[model samples]
Structure formats: C-alpha cells, structure tokens
Target: MGIAELRAESKTASESTAALLRELVAHLGENRTQLREEWIRRITEGRLLTAMSKDEIFAEATSVYDSYVEALETRTLEALQAYAQNLSERIIPRGVETHEVVGIVLLLRDVLARSLFSKYHADSRLLNAVLDAYEPAANAIAITVAVGFVRERERIIRQQQEAIRELSTPVLQVRERLLILPIIGLIDPLRARQLTEQLLRGVRANRAKLVVIDITGVAAMDATVANHLVLTVEAARLLGARVIVTGLSPEIAQTLVNIGVDLGKMNTVGDLQGGIEEAERLLGYKVVPIAEPMPA
Candidate 1:
C-alpha cells in the first residue's frame, strides 16, 4: 500500500480498537456486580488480602473494581494510578505483601476477561477484536497498580529509615562534665554530618570537660567519613570539651591514616572502659574501686 493508504488504514484500525474497548467497557459495567463478586471469590480462595477482614476486603474490592472500569472507559491511567497509591498507603500498614497486591489484581483481570468472553463469544471475529482491545488495557492496568504499590512501599521504608537514623544518633550526658556518644552500624555522609551536630550540641549543653566517642560497633570508614570523624572531634574541642575516641578498629584506623588524619592531635584509647578512666583522669577524679555488697 501507498504511504497515504497505510496511514489511513492505521487510523481506521485505531478507531476500531477504541470502539471495541468502549463496547467492552459498557458490558463490564452492566455486569459489574457479578464480575466483581467472582473476583472477590477468587481472591478469597487464593488467600489474597488475608490481612484484611471480609468487610474491609469488600469495601476495598468495590473501590478497585470501579477504578479498574473507569480506567478502561477513560483510556488513561492517571486516576487509577492515584487510587492504587492511596490504596497501598491504607493497606500496607495492615501487612499486605507485594505478591498479595499483585495477585488480587490479576484475579480481577481474569474475572473481567471471562465476562467479556461470555458476552462476545457467539461471533469469533467480534470476540477476537474485543479480546485484542481488552488485553493491552488489562496488562497496562496491572502494571500501573504494581508500579504504584512498589513506589509507595519504597517511600514508606525510606521515611522509617530516616526516623531510625535520627533516633539512633543521640549524644547522651553520662555524669557531671562527661558525655558519651556510642555510634554503631553503617554511617552514610548524612549520618556523619548528624554526628558532628549532635556532638557539638551535647558538649555545649552539658558544659562537658570530657567526651567519649565509642565506635566499637562500627567496622570501617571511608575517607569522607574519616574526615567527618575528625571534624566532629575538632568541633568538640572548639566548644572547650576534650574528645576521647575509643574502639579504633584496625580497618578504620587505616582509613584515617589514608585520609591524612593526624592521630597525634586526637586522643585515642583502647576500649570504652579505658576511655572513661582516661576522661576521669583528665578531670582529676581519683580512680577508687568500691566492691558491690553481696545480696542478703
């Protein structure tokens, strides 16, 4: 065919596809009750959405069914995408897994497909055309819901992780003129920055003469993190608090050396107990042992 002929043919096929989808959408709407009930039955049998009560499942299933039909009628996914994300937010905290979310959607697709087949089955050509129109939309709808759900889950996880990082980085006042900051786990650049801020605030607030930073739980550090550690020590010094670093792992010590960190300027100790003793010595406190009494 000539280019103009081919272009005209393509437009005609596109129009036909849209028309078929419209007809299929109307049939689904007319049979919405039976089809949605069938979908819910299958979901129950599959043990999907088990975290939810039957009433909760029915309410959510109704919303999802309506949204799915609406997306078909509109031929766009923006509304459906928003609804899926909202649904995910509501249900994820109820312990819904990704497989469960995806499973229910596929069940819905199957329920609707069987309905379409039953309605359009008398004429083979007509049935084929309707199926052709329905398959692409169904696949796209599934993908939209799946992607939205995953993105929302990732967002929640990141938010929780941020909260945990803030909670874990607290600088604690141990006694008069003494503070201890025990850092553990992995430290990103952002967390390293937080360490400096927390240390500075604690030293000033406590008017601490000595601060012990025990990094026994930390396994290693990169050059950037080593620099951040050095900066945190200097910030405490500028605030008139002498900093003692204990639990210097071999790997972290090498990272500091590689970063050109001058260990001579930083007071180092072997363990938390040794660092506390050294801090007490600098504050002119006598180390006297008092044994605990036995229980009567």
Candidate 2:
C-alpha cells in the first residue's frame, strides 16, 4: 500500500481498538455485580485480606471494583492511583501486606479476563481482537495499582523508621550550650550512623557547644561502630561542638584503643552524671555549696 493508504489503515485500526474497548467497558459495567462477587469469592478462597472482616472486605471490594473498571475505561490512572494510596493507608494499618494487595488485583484481572473469554468465545476473530485490546489495558491498570500501594507502603515504613530512630537515640538539651545523648541497646553500623545523624542535627539545632554522649545502656560496640563514634566526635568538633563520651564498656574501650583512636578527641567520662557535670563546668557553670545554720 502507498503512504496515504497506510495512514488510513492505521487510523482505522486505532478507532477499531477504541470501539472494542468501549464495548468491553460496557460489558464489564453490566456484569459488575456478578463479576465482583466472584472475585470476592476467589479472594476468600485464596485466604487473602484475612485481616479484614467479611463486611470490610466486601466494602473495599466494591470500591476497588469500581476503580478498576473506571481505570480500564478511561485509560487514565490518576484516580486509580489516588484510590490505591488511600486503600493502602487504610488496609496497611490493618496488617495488609504488599502481596495481599497485588494478589487481589491479579485475581480481579483473572476473573474479568475469564468473563470476557466466555462472552466472546463464539466469534474467534472478534475474540482475538477484544483480547488484544483488553490485555494491555488490564496489565497497565494492575501495575499502576500495585506500584501505588508499594510507594505508599514504603513511605509509611520510612516514617515509622524515623520515629524509631528518634526514640532510640535521644539528644536532650541539659543547659545552655550543653546537650546529652543517652544511647541504649546494641549499636550496629546503621543505628550508629543514625545516632551520629541525630546528634549532629541536635547540636546544630540547639547550637550546642558541649555534648555528652552516655552509652551506659549499650551492651557492646564493634570497632566499625566505634570508628563511627570517633567520626561523630570529629564531625562535632568541626561544627564547633566538643564531644564527651561516657559509659564506655571495657570491650568498646579496648576496641577504641586497638583502633588507635585518640582519647583526647573523644574526651571520655566515667558516667552520664560526670559527663553532664564536666559539660556544665566546661560551659562555665559553677556549683556553690550552701550551708544551713544550726539555729537561726
């Protein structure tokens, strides 16, 4: 065929695909009730969404079914993406996992594909054309939903991790230009790095001049984490903050020693109270003893 004839053929094919999709959407809408119920039944049989009660599952299924159909019909995913994010927020807190969310979408896709096959089986040519138009849209919709849920889940997970990091490594302002960080529990490289970050942020936020890090609650520390502690001290010094480390375990002290870390750099104290007192002293806070009279 000539170029003009080829162009006309392509336009006709595009319109024909759009018409097939419109018919597919209408058929799905007409059979929404039976198809959705069948999908729900399959979900129940598969033991998915067990975190939700039957009514909860049914309600969410209805919303998801409508969104799924809308996505396929419109060939757009913004509405479906928003719905998936909202659904993830609701269901994730109820212990719904990524696999469960993906599972139900695939199940719905399967159910709808089977229904389409049964509807168009008598006409082989039309069946092939319908399937050709439907499968790509169906796959795209499923990917959009699954991706939305995963992104939301990842965001929530990061939020929770930040909260945990704050709780685990607490940097408190003891006095003007003085802050204390009481680190408890095991210090892996990740936690140690988080500790460094929290301390640095606190120092900058408080404009802290002297910092006391108490690791009494810490059971042990490896050489790598000890290096992180040393690096933190160096970082603080560069930021115009002096670091005092307290509650050093024997193993950790030895690890620091073996690593040839300069004790002058770390400025170790025996305990949290001593570290605070030293911090206060360094900040020019003097303690005046007050004596009580025997008789007034």
Candidate 3:
C-alpha cells in the first residue's frame, strides 16, 4: 500500500481494534456475572440440601453441583468460540489485511484459560472444560495469521518503559552542581540496588552537589525497597552529594509510615519542581525576578 493508504488503513484498524476490545470486555463482564450468580445459587442450594448425613447428602450435593458446572462450561465455550469466529470474519472479509487480522487473532490468544480459571475456580471440572474448549477456539480463531501481534505489543511496551527509565535517571548537567536519576517500574530490592549504584556513580563522576532521584513511574515499594532508598541516600551523603527524592506519592508515603521508614536525614519533595527549588535553596541561590548582570 502507498503511504497515505497505509496511514488510512492503520487509523481504521486502530479504531476497529478499540471497538473490538470494548465489545470483548462487555461480553466477558456479562459472562462473568452469569457464572458468579450460577455458582452462588448452586453452592447455596447444595448447602441447604445437607441433611447432616455424613455420606449420602455430601456425595449427592457434590455430584449435582459438578453436573451444573459442566453444563455451564459447555455453554461458555460455545459462546466464546462463536464470538471469536464472528470477530475474525468481520475483520478479515475476503483477503486478510495482515495487520488488522493479526490484531483480532491476538485478542483471542491473550485471553487464556488460566485467567478465566482464576475468576471461575469454584468448580474444577467446569474450569477444565472451559480450557478444553478455549484451546480449540483460540486455535480456530485464525491466530496463526496474527500470531506475532501480541509479542509485538509486549516488545513495544518494554522498549518504551526502558526509554522512560533512562530519561528518569539523569546524567550530569554541570560539575558539582546538578545530577539526575530515574527509578522506573516497581521499586524492588534488585532494582533499588541497581539504581543505588547508578546514583552513586553518576553523583561521584559528575561531582554533583545535588542529585535528583525521580520515582514517578514506580508502582510501589516494599520495606526492602524503602531500605534500598535509604542506602542510596546514605551512599550519596558519603559522596558529599545532597540527594533530592522526587515523586513522593501519598500512598507511598503511607506505605513508608506503615513500614516505620523515617526519611529524616534525606530530603523528600513532591516532584522534580519542588526538588529543584529545594536544591537551589540548599545551594544558596534564589529565583530572582530579573537576571543580574555579571560584574567584570
């Protein structure tokens, strides 16, 4: 396809993909509600049926529940398969537009039995039956045509995150004056340790008086994570660099308090802007309204 045609096609595919996802979400939600209600009803009925008979009532109730679960599983499998087939046909009418076809196929592959089972594990037999049908449905949903789409998405996300992390971890701006470091993803011990090393090296190498450690992208930090942060601050102090912690989420602050992490010695700020202001103050500089002329 020509560039304009390709762009148009891409836009169309993107819109369709979003629409399909919404439809799939709605379908799954409806099915999930149905499954939960059925399971609840069956379990409630089974509990009431118990006559305190140690053997007969228990066995009968178990069997009845199992039968009901199996029937439900069969219905779910048929419905999902029908849905997948319908979506596939709609996206790829005559000759498959390779990109759009792949996207639709991947939608089926990414939704797996393990996830569904996690949601509906009240009945093992039903879960197994769903898996049995899900496998065939996924295979038949023309996944072969777009098998790499999911992988491509995963790869793109990974690359973008890595780039953001790199951006967050700042390099030296000026000698013994400024430094930046970014913490990306979850703040775990391993990542924290790595970040600590990066900060220490960057600070020492650049002779940074102020080091900014940004954690805006971090999901959460456990006690171990908190310890790593403390260690990094201590290490930076030893290197004669003031550590400026940025991106202090209220939830993270609460987590630190709950974990008994007293960030007393290290300076904490709301964001990079606050950190910059604090850094300027610490350096005995002020943001004046007018730029002062240099005395020759």
Candidate 4:
C-alpha cells in the first residue's frame, strides 16, 4: 500500500480499537458475567451434541475449550495494542458514536489498497459534517474577539481625535452664551473653508450673539488666509452674529495697520477677558459679587 493508504489504515485501526474497547467495557460490566454466560451457553450446546465414546468426547471438549481460550487471548492482545497506540496519539478512545467509527473504518479500508483517485476519493462528507457542527461555536468566538478589538480601537481613536481638536485652537467662552473661536493652526485656504462652515453652523445652532476671533495664535498668514478670514467674519455677520477681533500681537497689529486693513467697521479688543467683558457690557449685564458693602 502507498504511504497515504498506510496512514489511513493506521487511523482506522486506532478509531476502531477505541470503539471496540468502549463496547467491551459495557459488555464486560458485572465482572464479565454477560460474556461468561454466553460462553457457557455455547459450550453447553456443543457438549450435548457429542454422542461419541468417552475419550472422543473428552478430546472434543478439550479442543473446543483450547480454541476458545486462544481466540480470546489474540483479541485481548490486539485490543491492548490498539489502546496503547491511541494513548500515544492522544486519541479519545471511548464515547465515540457508531457513525464516527463507521467513517474511520471506511477510510481505513480505502488505505489498504491503491486505486485510481476517482475510484476512491475520501468521502469528505463525514469530516465536513463534523466541521459544520463546530462552525457556529468558532464563528461566535471570532466575532466576539473582533468586536472587542473594534471597540478598543474606536475608543483609542476618539481619545486621539479629542486631543488633536483641543490642540488645534484655544476656545474662549463668552458669557455662557457665546464663544470666540481663536484658531491656532495654519489658516490655509482649506482650514479657513472648513472653519467657516463649522463656525456658521455653531453660531446658528447655539444662537450665539457674538464671536470674537482672536488671531494672536496665527504665526503667519498669506493674502489668501487673510481674505478667507475676512469672508468668514462677513458670513458670521449675515447670520446675525457680531464679531470681535482680539489678541492682536504687536507684530500682527503693525502689519494690519501698515497694510491698511480696515478696522473702522470692526470692534477689536486686546485680550479674551476684555472681549468677554465688552460683550457683556453691550448686552447690559454686569458680573458683580452679591454682598453688602463693608465699612471700617
């Protein structure tokens, strides 16, 4: 037989031996009483048919007893060898169903002789069924692991995104009703465009009355960035939101002043607190302590 056949035979032998052992264990319960009884019945029936002389009868009975003993011993040896092989290979020898044993036996039979591939393709149906039984359990485990990983990844990504957003700009809260967006990163055309959309949406949704854009964080700006800022301010105005320019460092202030950027139409403040106080003044509210005056 080919190597494949030999291997197949070996597996079949292992499986069969295991199955036989299970059957034998069940059969031999009660101190082998069942086996003993069956043997006794067979022997008794055979002895009754011996109607020959005493010597002939004695010889015939002895021969039958010896044959039975030898057969039992041979079977015992084969079973012991099968058990040992199974232990070495880590095969669970007991509790196997008939269908499993049948499958293994079929495989073993195929291995004993070499033939064309089409003549005896190993029937995959049995193995397939076994795999099918395990599919749902395996898939459940895989999905659980995948979902856990995805949740963990999403959490990590959200944390990182929050950090980036925070570092992108300094938020100036105004009177608990308005916010001044002071962008720090480069206000290139793309960023300016995105900021415009965000601010407009925020102002309308929040019903903001004022937005003081502090430009001190801006390191440098080209004409395009400058023009985008102008357009952003105009859009906020159209949405019924007032705009204040603040945090104008000396250098930027000088540049805007020299460039003749129009400041006559815009309200400007020097710092964030100053801007908020100005907005609160315009709204006719004063933040003061509610305590009686003390006299010495």
Candidate 5:
C-alpha cells in the first residue's frame, strides 16, 4: 500500500481502538453494580479476601471498579494509582495483606475479560482488537495499583518502626535537671544504640545533670545487654550527665558480675523511687509535702 493509505489505515485502527475502549468503559459504568457483585463474589471465594465483610468488600470494589473505568476512559494510570493509594491507606491498617490487594485487582481483570469475551465472541476481529487494547490497559492499571499499594505499605512500615523505637526508649524529665528512662523490656544491641541516642538527646534537651535509668520492668539481662548498659553509662558521663542505674534485679546483678562488666563508678539505686530521690539529692532539692489547709 502507498504511504498515505498506510497512514490512513493506522489512523482508522487507532480510532477503532479508542472507540472500543470507550465502549468498554461505558459498559463498565452502566453495569457497575453487577460487575462489583461478581467481583466481590469471586474475591470472597478466593483465599485473600475471606476476612473482609461484605459491605467492606463491596465498598472497596465499587471504588476500584469506578476508578478502573475512569482510567480506561482517560487512558491514564493516575486514577488507578490514586484509588490504590487510598485503598491501601484504608486497608493496610485493617490488616489487609499486599498479596490480597493484588489478588483483588487480578480478579477484576478476570471478570471484565470474561464478560467482554462472552458478549463479543461472534466478531473475532473486533473481539481480538478489543481484548488486545483492554488486556494491556487492565494489566497496566493493576501493576500501577500494586506499585502504589506497596509504596504506601513500605511508608507505613517505616512509620511504625519509628514509633516503636520511640516507645521502646522513652526519656522523660521528671524534675529540674533530672531525667528518667524506664527500661521495661529486653534490651538488645540495636535497642541499646537507640537508647543511648535518646538519652543523649534527652540530656541535651532537658539540660539534665542527672539521668536515672530504672530497669524495674526488665525481664532479663545477658552479656550483650550488660555491655550495652556499661556503654550507655560511659556515653552519658562523656556528655556531662551523671548516670544512676537502678532496679537491677538479683539475677541481672549476678549476670553483670559474672560477665565482669563493672559499673562501679556509676551511681546505683535499689528502685525507681530511690533513683528519683538520688537524682533530687544530687540536684540539691528535696520534695517536702505541704500541709493541707484546715477545713472550712
């Protein structure tokens, strides 16, 4: 064929593909409820979406279905990505797994393709063109959704890790120039590093001269933990903050002694109250209870 004829044929094919996609989008919009119900049914029967209630499933399916139709109409992945990010934010905290999210997207593709094939089986050429256009668009949308979901999930995980780090090693200022860090759980090397960072930051922030590390809630201590504690005390001293180690259980004390980890230069207290008292004494303050006013 001549170049002009070939160009014309290509333009016609392009127009045809665009028209078919619009038709598919229209069909999806018109039959949304039916398609969503089928999608939900398939997802419910599958392994991934068993925990979700029907209402939850239907709501999410409706959102995804409508977004997918919009994406097809616009021939862009933006709608799908926005919908996926919103869905991920809602569902990840609800305990929906990543694979489950991807599974639901695949299920939508399956249902739509099946419905399309059933309606257009008589016209092979048109059916082929529609499928060719639809499959890639659907797959691309699914991939975009999955990517968005995964990125959001990763962000949530990072946030959770930061929160846990803060919770695991909280430094509190109980009085002027006095700070207390109550270590309630097992301290590993990583946590020890986090604790040291928090302690130093807290000391600087509070202008603390004394830091009381109360370990009353600690369950156990090993050589590594002992080493971490010793390092923390030494670091605090370097920062000009005197460290008081308190609430050392008999077991932990023996463990520390057996490991030959010496904390002799650091102040020692029997309990949290003792630590507080010592901190106050070092700061030259005493908590004197005020007498209550006589009843009227």
Candidate 6:
C-alpha cells in the first residue's frame, strides 16, 4: 500500500477505536447497577473485601466503575487517579489492606473486559483495539491505587514513631530551678540519644539548677544503657546543671559497678522523694511540718 493509503487506514482505525470506547462506556453506564452487583458479588464471594458492609461495598464499587468509565471515555488518567486517592483515604482507616485495594481494581477490569468481549464477539478489529486501550488503563488504575495506599501507610507509621519517642522520654519541671526525667521501659541506643537531647533542651528551657533522673520504671540495664546515662549526666553538667541519679535498684546498681562504671563523682539518691529533697536542699529550701491548731 502507498504511504497515503496507510496513513488513511491508520486514521480510520483510530477513529473506529474511539467510537468503540464511547459505545462501551455508554453500555457500562446503562448497566452500571448490574456491573456493580457483579463486581461486588465476585469480591465478597472471594472474601477479598471482608470488613466492609454491603452498603459500603456497593458504594465503593459504584464509584470505581463510574471513574473507570469516565477515564475510558475521556482518554484521561487523572479521573482514575483522583478516584484512587479518595478511595485510598476512605478505606485505609477502615483497615483495608493495599493488596485488597489493588485486587478490587483488577477484578473490576476483568468483569468489564468480559462484558465487552461478550457484546462484541464478532468484531475482531474493534475488540483488539478496545483491549489495547482497556488493559493499560486498568494497570494504571491499579498502580495509582497502590501508590496512594502505600503513601498513607508510611505517613501513619511516621506519626506513630514520633508519638512513641515523645512518650518514651518525658521531661517535667517539678519546681523552680528543678527538673525531673522519669525514665520508663528499655532505653535502647536510639532512645538514649533521644533522652539526652530532650534532657539538654529541658535544662536550658527551664534554666534548671538541678535535674533528677529517676529510673524506677526501668526494669533492667545493660552496659550500653549505663554509658548512655553517664553521657546524659555529663552533658547536663556541662550545661551547668547538677544531675542527681535516683531509683537505682540493687540489680542495676550492681550492673553499673560490675561494668566498672564509677558514678562516685556524681550525686546519687535512693528514690524520687530523696532526690527531690536533695534538689530542694541544694536550692537552699527546707520542708517543715506545720503545728496543729489549738482546740477552741
């Protein structure tokens, strides 16, 4: 064939494909409820969407079907992407997994393709063209949905980690010129580093003259943890804050000595109450009991 004839044939094929896409979209729109029902049945029967109610399943299925049809008709992927983002946000909080989200998209694609093939069985050229457009669009939709789910999950994980760090190391200003850091749980290297940073910040912020580190909640200690504690104390001392170690259980105390850690240069107290008293005494204050009132 001549170049012009080949160009003419390609144009005709392109136009024919567009027309078939429009027709397919129209058919899907007309049978929207039926399509959604079939999609939902397949998903529910497969136990893929187990946590969602019937209403929720139907609603999600309808939205997905509508978005797919819109994208196929308009020849744009933005509609599907927007729909995926919205769907991901809605379903993520409902405990839907990423795999389930992608599975639903793939299932809908299969159902729609089956419907199209059944309707246009005799038109081989049109069927081929439709498949060419539909398969890529389906894959794109699945990818976009998966991306949205993963992004949201990662954001949630980061938020949770931040919360955990805050809870693990809490600094409190118990009184004027006095701060307390009540350590709880295991103090890994990362948490120890975080604790050091927090202690320094708190000391500067409160202009604290004394810091009492109470480790009553700590179940055990290791050599590395003991070193972290020593480093934190040293850092606080450099900032001109006197640090008093408190809540040293016999086991932990033995651990410190067995590891050849000499806390003798630092002030040590038996408990939080003793630490508070020592802090008050260093600040030149003394607590005294009041006398009882005489009976009238």
Winner by TM-score: 2
lDDT of each residue in 79-170, candidate 3, tens digit only = 33334344334333333344544432343244334456675589887556555544443443334334333344455567777676556555
- Stretches of candidate 4 off by over 4 Å are 1-173, 254-260, 285-296
Q: Rate the local accuracy (lDDT) of all candidates.
A: 0.85, 0.86, 0.55, 0.50, 0.82, 0.80
lDDT of 4 by residue, 170-234 (tens): 44455655777877856667667667777888788778778878886887777666666677777
How well does each candidate superpose onto the true structure, as a TM-score? 0.72, 0.85, 0.39, 0.39, 0.78, 0.80
Q: Report the C-alpha lDDT of model 1 over 171-270, residue by residue, as the tens digit.
A: 8887788999999999889999878887888888888878999999999988889898998888888878889999999999998888888877688999
**TM-score for model 1?**
0.72
- lDDT for model 4 comes to 0.50
Candidate 6 residue-wise lDDT, 1-296, digit = tens: 22233234335556666676677779889988888889889999778878899988888888888887876677666666677777777877888887788788888888988988887789988788778756655566666667767887788878889789988878999898899999998878888888899999999999988999999999788889887888788889889888999998887888888887766656789999999998887776323335332211
lDDT of 2 at 160: 96
Arrange candidates by lDDT, highest first: which order? Answer: 2, 1, 5, 6, 3, 4
* lDDT of model 3, residue 226: 79
lDDT, candidate 5, equals: 0.82
RMSD of 1: 8.8
By summed lDDT, the worst window of 10 consecutive residues in model 5 runs over 287-296
lDDT of 2 by residue, 1-296 (tens): 22233234335658888889899999999999999999999999999999999999999999999998887677667788889889989888899988999999999999999998999999999999999878777777788788888999899999998899779888899798899899998888989888898889999999998899999998778889989999999999889898889999898888899999987667999999999987776666324335332110
In model 5, the clashing pairs are none
Among all candidates shown, the one with the greatest lDDT: 2
Error of 4 at 104 (Å): 36
- Candidate 1 residues lying further than 4 Å off, grouped into runs, are 1-13, 173-179, 185-211, 216-228, 235-242, 246-263, 268-296
